[model samples]
Target: MITRVRSELTRYLRTETVGGALLLIAAAVALIWVNSPWGASYQTMVDTSLAIPALHLDLTLADWTKDGLLAIFFFVAGLELKREFVVGELADPRRAALPIIAAVGGVVVPAAIALAVGHGAPGMDNGWAIPVATDIAFALAVLAMTGSRIPVSARVFLLSLAVVDDLLAIILIAVLFTASLSLLWLGAAVACCVAWGLAQKYRLHTPLFYIPVALICWYALHEAGIHPTLAGVALGLLTRVRKDPGERTAPATHLEHVVQPISAGFCVPLFALFASGVPLNTAVLGSLFTDRLALAIVLGLLLGKTIGIFGVSWLAIRLGVAKRPVGLEYRDMFALSVLGAIGFTVSLLVAELALADVGAETIELAKAAVLVTSMAASVLGSALLLRRGRVHQARRDADQLPQGEGSTK
Candidate 1:
């Protein structure tokens, strides 16, 4: 049994993409169930009351999934963000320019666009951050379908871009999204996080020591008026692992290996089920487009993502901060830009926060908007990527032809 578990673990670690696909599947299932005849049952199940006698904690299953399970997902995201900044492509300042610039542009533009559409509308301005994220799972899936013909630089560029986008979104949530503050608890949370950081700096050999501290930090932040999700990022950045490929392995990498799967496989999917579930009655949804929530979400994602990512990427290449990816041009990247608009995981989370206390009707419309735009962006972007691959292949084939054999000249 142990051996079988080991084998499965090894396989899953190697194929990280499967975890992402599972997340998508979970989201799809939630969407279907919510819109089905049994939708009320699904809602009831998620909304059922639950309590932990030991901890004196009480929340609906759905809230627990979103606030609790999703924290683990963000924790993993934080680790990935840290890993990238430490040694990945993002580690290099020069190589990082194109993606960073594109990410900046992508985030700002969508936010501005969302703001423009919903300006002066009640509770509308709060949702500007919804469209600024790029779902790594969906982006990677799209890239994989393009085959090996796409240059490695392009893939690296996209990955780096997404990481940067996540970073921005995290900050936005911490700053723009939070409404109140609890200074006393906030200080306690910071202190705990600081102690964790000191442990890493001193090469603390034990990972277990950080767990209790992290829990305290989570609760402290929760009470401190900071969004609890920020705690994940704090812990992730504080944990460092050094990789010594030949002789020894790094502590951070080892921890990440264990943590990443849990985050990707279990935490992220469960979070999606909770966060992304929204029931839609056609009659109700038809009127949603006119609402501030729906319009902000839809336009923010569709317009902000494309212009922000591609526009800045082009400028970066032109300004010589970074070179364009080999065999990929402005047009190819534009397609990838669209793909970045599929903001399933993060968008919904932000939407929940944005629509907080806004009433059930408003939240429903926001969810619908996210659902519609995510689907549209995915389909259109995938088609463009596939088409681009065909064009690239045709060009390659023509180049390989016998000298003067197929030349029109």
Candidate 2:
């Protein structure tokens, strides 16, 4: 019975739709709970602090979710990214260029728009980074549900684009958010990463060997004043992706399979629960439009992402710089570009980090913008995808019809 239950849980967590649904549900519950009469309890729980003197860690429940749990998500992302570069869609330079360029364009244009709109606004310097990421799980979930009739290559293109998009966002987080750096702790973190790589090379496959090293690396980074999440990415990239003869799977692949369920099922949803509890009173709602920073985030996501992704992709194909995915027309690409605007997960993190010094009210408004913009992007993207699906379905049905059956009728 225990084995069966474990099997069932793994299966559910592995489903893309289930993970996305759970994330949304968690965010919704947070919104409702925080706005209800018992809202104070929600804040109290999130604010409850736990200290680890041995590790020199003191963080609230919310900080733990953001700084600690989210690292697991990034680790999984790192594994997928390494696999893609080694063997997946991004393995070949020719096949990789389109998504890479599109990802860059997606990042740059939204940032430019944000800067243009929110110039001189408080926290605009860092807050402009908020809309540059595409949430892989959320975007893939929407695609899986609505793009059933779309060609398989479209999904591949989306996946590749998102992976590169996330890499850029992680780099930005590491570079832009570090307030101070301690070389001693940074050296310790680097040594731990090297140790992890050595373990992989030596074929040490036990979790007992890795969990402690990973924790130490995370703590080292935390003490170094770097975002500890970078430790997860480093460890992930260090994991071996190549399989030896007679091996069933590469170490990276195995780790991803083991860790993905935990990241999706628990870590991300729990983060959403704590991070998404923004107050939505009349003033806050009004402020979403009136506040320049909030307005910039919303516009950057809704307009900037679409224009950046689709516009660059179109130009790249026209100039013969990159090839479009097979079976994907410009219309389908536009839909995918719209889907790219769903920047929920990383955007929320950036909103918090960028505005940590700005004030709680500004942070709340920024998060509200992210949530609203993501919802709008999802609806718009889904509508476009469903329409495209219907068109493709009609074409497929017509092609399958008996020859001359309806001709001249």
CA lDDT, every model vs. true structure: 0.79, 0.94
TM-score of every candidate relative to the true structure = 0.91, 0.98
Candidate 2 residue pairs in backbone clash: none
Model 1: residues with Cα > 4 Å off, grouped in runs: 13-16, 53-56, 146-148, 244-247, 395-409
Best by TM-score: 2
Tens-place lDDT digits, model 1, residues 1-409: 9999987975684354676677778888998988888888888988898987676568788777777777776777777778888888778888777788888998999989899888877667677777788887667766775534655666787878887888789898899766789899999999999999898777776658888888889888877878888898888877775554562666667766777777777888888877667776776578567776578778889888998888888887888888776678887899889988988778888888877777777777787888789889888987888887788888888888765585855
lDDT of 1 at 324: 78
Models, CA RMSD each: 3.2, 1.8
Query: Which candidate achieves the best lDDT against the true structure?
Result: 2
